[model samples]
Target: MALSSQTTALAQIPRVHIFPTAGEAADAVAEHLLATVKRNPKSVLGLATGQTPRHVYAKLVHAFREGKISFCDVETFNLDEYCGLTASHPDSFAAFMQRELFGLADFDPRKTNLINGDVQDVVAEARRYATRLKESGAVDVQLLGLGTNGHIGFNEPGSASDSHVRVVDLADETLSANQPSLIELTSVPERAITIGIADILHAREIVMLATGSAKAGAVRRSLREAPSTDCPASFLGTHQAVHWYLDNAAAAEIG
Candidate 1:
């Protein structure tokens, strides 16, 4: 909802805002997320991991410490996880959320849902996670990080628009971008379990954040180009309540 009054629409898109700095954009997003929690204590949050949301999570953690919010009634579902890493792995999305948000906040362990990537039956795990998501009623808001290759939640460029949660082969660009330095290059995960585009669109509200010049092209295409699987983020244009938060660098390629 009007988190920042300094909003502008691009083409037919809704609520696109370009902040002067990444910190400002992140602060606005954190405030918006906290507003949702305050309005609905039982809100189901669709969370994301990566540099894009790191600052936002920090703000959320600060709010929890300042008694501005409580996650006692909030439930969280992460976007995706590496297929080979254990939840305890330092590089895993689960561990990242723990270190960045869950560990710093007051979230209930039982209510925090993350795909366990170490399981033997990855397909069954995906289905099970999807069922859990469906049982949650619906996600109040979904936070997303745009990949350089126009992916979201590890849903690669060629992903189906109507696809559901599933295990997907990681695109070369994605693997390269996320390759852990501590592990051998060959040991890097080649697959990930991600919620599908359909699941993401089901959220009542979507907040897509992109920063840095590397994201400029994807951000431009997402808002200006036709909705196509070639740029998975472009499909976000079809959602009625999508808000885009970008810094000047990310918005540079936009006309």
Candidate 2:
């Protein structure tokens, strides 16, 4: 309940904050997330992946090491995972979390949940994942990183609104942006399992982060353009409580 934000007249305009640097924004976000953890010891949290959250998680890891925060009572669900990758794969989202946050902090292993990209029954896994999310109730706060193409999770352009948990084809831009994990562009997985737009909107609160000049155009389009399947991140504006955190470079086009 602490993380639940009241509805506002921001359906077409989302609250935005521009930070001088990515480190400052990440520290701010870490403070907000830690507040939720302290407010409700047993909160359910949703997390995102990619380069944007790297700093945020680093800040969080520092806090945990300093005894400023603890994830021992927090349960987490990741936004998506690349298809055909295993939990042990260096490129997998699970591995990313393990290396960046979980491994460095006091997190509960039993409480951490992620989609298994290596599973053969992708549809069934999606359905099961959706059911689990529904049963857990509204995620206290969902952390997101904007894709260069306006994708939230793997809900690429043209993704259906009614789309719940499902396996989806990756956009060319999304695949390229994930190059850090793959050996080469050709090694990037072409598919992903993701929670849908509907599920994300149902979250109690949504916190999206953007940094670097590469995201300037996408950030502008997502906030200025109409909310449609063409720009999945724009849908966050429709949510009652959402926070948009952008670094100066990422906010360059937001005037």
Candidate 3:
């Protein structure tokens, strides 16, 4: 559990925030996001899609409906998308965003960007997405959800530290972990187009959320272990301004 030399040299000791319940943790994250938006109406947000973020998105939707926030001027970029799935596909990350957040919020469709998972040439798509991210300046806040295997944005185990936006084959653990989430697709996706670990690190700030006992081990490893490709999320420890939001269950194994 000792910090690696590289991680020790760069990390400022990430802030960990634990809440009594998952909803409470989500509430805190929502407030932080709202604060970021208030500080910069034109803020570019790096967003995540999954069960972990559903509550956060719901809170944002409620905020929008209550006249507390508006995403009309905010631009967003999704973290990853399953390959071979079109934006409109029911199981696609784009569809998840629409169903969970974008459809209910005031976000402008033109300003929201996501990788074309079904593109004929995934390499070109990766480059295009990366270029768009660069043109937007730094992301004000990058929201993340931990994978059971310690990945962030599909930056699976063995991913290089300097990796950028690219297409990656999904690990078996990832596929198994995500299989239950897909209601429409009979089979899980084997590959994904993801914004790389390096790109995620470049964001001005990062907010990672983990809830439930299912994520306890991964949470422990990510925070207590040294930075390594074996646990991609471990690399977040090297970022100077990363915040971890966990419910008691997810934080169970951390200490």
Tens digits of per-residue lDDT for model 1, 1-255: 443444334423458877768898888899889999999999999999988899999999999999989999999999999888899887788988998999998899999999999999999999999999999977999999999999999999999889889999999988777765333335568899999999999999999989888899999888889999999999999999998988878888884
Candidate 2 C-alpha error for residue 243, in Å: 0.3
Question: lDDT scores for all predictions?
Answer: 0.89, 0.84, 0.90
**Pairs of colliding residues, candidate 2:** none
What is the lDDT, from 0 to 100, of the residue 81 in candidate 2? Answer: 89
List ranges where model 3 is wrong by over 4 Å. Answer: 1-14
For each candidate in turn, the TM-score is: 0.94, 0.92, 0.94
Stretches off by above 4 angstroms in model 1 are 1-13, 180-187
Please give the ranking of all candidate structures by lDDT, highest first, separated by commas. 3, 1, 2
Q: Kindly list the per-residue Cα lDDT of model 3 for residues 1-255, writing each as its tens digit.
A: 122222322234447877778998888899889999998899999999889999999999999999998899999999999999999999999999999999998999999998898889999999999999989988989999999999999999898789999999999988988988996999889999999999999999999999999999999899999999999999998898988988888888765
Q: How close is candidate 3 to the true structure, as a TM-score?
A: 0.94
> Deviation in angstroms for 75 in model 3?
0.7
